[model samples]
Target: MSTRLDELVQELGQADRQERIELLIDLARELPPLPDRLAGSRDESHRVPECQSPVFLFVEPAESGRIRLYADAPAEAPTVRGFVALLVAGLDGATPAEVANLPDDILDRSGVREILGMQRISGLYGILRRLRALAAQLPQPESPAKMPADTPSADPPSAASSDPSTAAASTPDPEALIAALRTVTDPELHVNVIDLGLVYGIQTQGHEVHVEMTLTSPACPAGPQMIRDAVAALEKVEGVTKAHVKLVMNPPWSPDRMTDAARDELGIF
Candidate 1:
């Protein structure tokens, strides 16, 4: 393990829930300011679209084999900022090979998974994957493209198909759509959104499907990523060609909406 990562794991391991959050915020504050060229709207190419927050990341390779990481996240999204802060600080000055070999489950060891939830953990993985991809430019072994096991595919099936038979065969089933959605978990609550009653409705028209869902809170930072993941999950079904998600605030979510199984898992009376 890298020294910095080891130290981070130790620090996180010792902190309680609230203290861990405070430590993350402190790390966010410590993230060095990005150079003007890489800040603001200038670095669109470096943006991590997989992140719920509008996070931009860039990797700079040094002659000495070490690489420098630059990242920017909104202050409103402190959790993401902190996550990027952790990566920037921990991986700074590490060689491209070192980063490429970094453990896939490093975040799990950091104890952040218990606090930040799976969505944020998955976003962290997205950052690492992008970082490694950038670093691979430095003459690394060729590896087949692979999506993170915990993340949904970023590329959905193309809506435009040349064959009508193919398009018709790709029509999604409502039952299958709901089943695929059951695989998505609420980041904060750690419960499947279906069981939590976050899914308001599902509709399918030929090869296109639409879903209506709500977040536990109107201000949930993970909302965008969740929607993206939902779309991706739907698109992965054998017959889905297009997936559309609509966020609904009306008929707002409540604990009362959760299934008895969810309540049991959460220890709610």
Candidate 2:
């Protein structure tokens, strides 16, 4: 069985440009519609927004109507945004509460830098206003969002501790360890770091451990997040300690490094 990320990748490849785009637009429509009650919630301007990127993100209230957002990036722009929108749309049918249940691996499926970049997301609030208006006209409907147990989460106090040397020295639990790290993905690629071949090296001797990793882009926004998440992911290992993480920009990440599964997910064939 593939992870939700795997399902999303396959779906994106199968969708046409227009279909992929509208799918995101619909997700923008799914965020809980903000209300006059949210006066204390926002900065008081209370205006909505649109997604210029293919993916649209919004925080929604558990109850009531819908929140709509859209950002129509030029088809020529970088593609990952569209991919995000596409994936989120498929995930959107679930209630905001349910969607929130998603593990960081599936909901975020992105490297730390990517999640952090969202803090400075640009363009298209106008589209959000339009979607919100559109939702008001439709009959209200709801669904439950359930997070699968295997999903990856992005909570704090990462497995990587204040002391990398100590963390690396602990005994290891490979399955739990890999599960934790699989949650770390290349932000732009929205794919697991493991699949991206970003992990350059791993050396273990008894309890002591060492690790090396790289970014998909030299200036990736998810850098800090990836670093932080990597440490956390590795920290979960029982015998692992001193989980050292090193970042490399040389050689860079290439399509050649992509796993066969990753490639097939992108429909490269």
Candidate 3:
């Protein structure tokens, strides 16, 4: 039998883009408020730092030996709120192992990526990460009776851990981060920021990446979105836990900075 989350992912995968958005909005409306006990405790400590929206999560063991996940996100951020609600509905009653064993790419698998901006997607990833980390801290199930029907007793190791090459690639590297950023494009130009000479520098420390880049112009309207996209792209890399993007304008962007490919595409002589 498929879990509620598995069915939900299938539904999202089957829906058209517009219908998916509507479904997400409806799910957002379904997120219940934090219970009175946890209501007063939704402070900075419980907040998910990656989300731009004010989102908080709490996990507690249920009387039935399952775990309950409670989340709170403002009504204004429907996308994030919807994802939180979806998780709660799907996994709230699941055993710790089930929640901990969730696939890391559940967001992409659901096909919701099409409707979400890169920044929002990154934030949602953070929420999942936070949830899983909290789940890992819970006590493990001692017997088969504790496992839910949705979760199988025998489980395979995650690909990242099972594959030698994949395990090695999980650490953030300059090349990987750069390659990831190459996917972000300037909305107006349809040219990747990398080829457009928008990215100035990239630094990596452990799982974090720090970037310094400039825009076409100081007043470029797409600056903010571009920055967010760049950050999202970097963080999406297997090992990157955080991405910091800095905007620098001291050296103004000029056509001279564009890569040959970008110039050729733009028909610049």
Candidate 4:
């Protein structure tokens, strides 16, 4: 059998853009999610106590090449959403100095928790990186003013072949769309669709958008309802003319999807 990497490399060379993207989704299925909790019990780590409750974490990429990070922490459990957001923020282009010098007060604030549906600061930074990388590899944009100084200091080959208007029209601000998605609540879970892991990836191409997520239960009868709700939520976002949802079952769901913070709040250890 061909390994995912081998298949991906082969697919990369294919002429069809759709086929290459299909390979990306297929390869994603093979990736092992990051571990949620450290080994050992609360007795092992006196500094951080574990919750007696349960929590779950789920992440999915959007059509716009952004990821939706979800955490389901019942009220009974502690909420580590803030910490996860901070980690994500630091992952961005902020200079090591900027990230390191950040005040603890800012990190301790619950604003991050309230904004779980938004892109982690670092996630949007990735878009800036990719834009630059592709630009470097490809031809320079017709308008230099459109490029930000911090934008990919070293431009790579440009994957952007269209004009500035086409490029801007195609890309959606990852953070903005994520914030919009947070408003969507799972009809059954009663929490934000984001918290219930009902909203996964969001993708945008020109005026079209696609979201990919999975229901907690494979046989969920609310699948259609969830899809409708998600589409409705995304359509409300400005600049989105079309939206779609794809429910993926590959690799299955488990507590492993929970973030480090979610694990701590739930004491999943």
lDDT of 1: 0.70
Ordered by TM-score, highest first, the candidates read 3, 1, 4, 2
What is candidate 1's lDDT per residue for 1-269, written digit by digit as tens? 46896788678768888998898899889989888876765354576656777788777877666787788888887767887888788888777767756665667766778888865576776666666555544543333222222233345535444356666666666668878888888888888778887885666655666677789889999999889889899989877777777887744455545745323322100
Task: Please provide, for model 4 over 1-269, each residue's C-alpha lDDT reduced to its tens digit, 9 standing for 90 to 100.
Answer: 11322233333444254553343344334333334552122231221113223323333333333333333323321123223332333323322222222333331132321233343333322222222222222222231322222222232324441345766855556555666767866566665655554443555654545566677679878778877777787767776665666776532333323433322221100
- In the range 1-269, model 2's lDDT, one tens digit per residue, is 12553566455445565664454445334433334554344431222333444333344433354333322233443333444454345444434323323333432332222432555433322322223322322333552212212223343334454456765555575555556667988777788977776764454434434555677778788888998888877866776544656675533454434645322222100
Sorted on lDDT, highest at the top, how do the candidates line up? 3, 1, 2, 4
lDDT of 4: 0.41
Candidate 4 scores a C-alpha RMSD against the true structure in Å of 19.6
lDDT of candidates 1 onward, in order:
0.70, 0.46, 0.73, 0.41
The TM-score of predicted model 1 comes to 0.50
In the range 181-217, model 3's lDDT, one tens digit per residue, is: 8899999999988888777556554555667778988
**Total backbone collisions, model 4:** 23
Q: Give model 2's TM-score versus the native structure.
A: 0.33
TM-score, each model? 0.50, 0.33, 0.52, 0.37
- Give me the candidate number with maximum lDDT: 3
Steric clashes per prediction:
0, 32, 0, 23
Off by over 4 Å in 4: 1-164, 167-171, 256-269
For model 4 the local lDDT of residue 204 reads 60
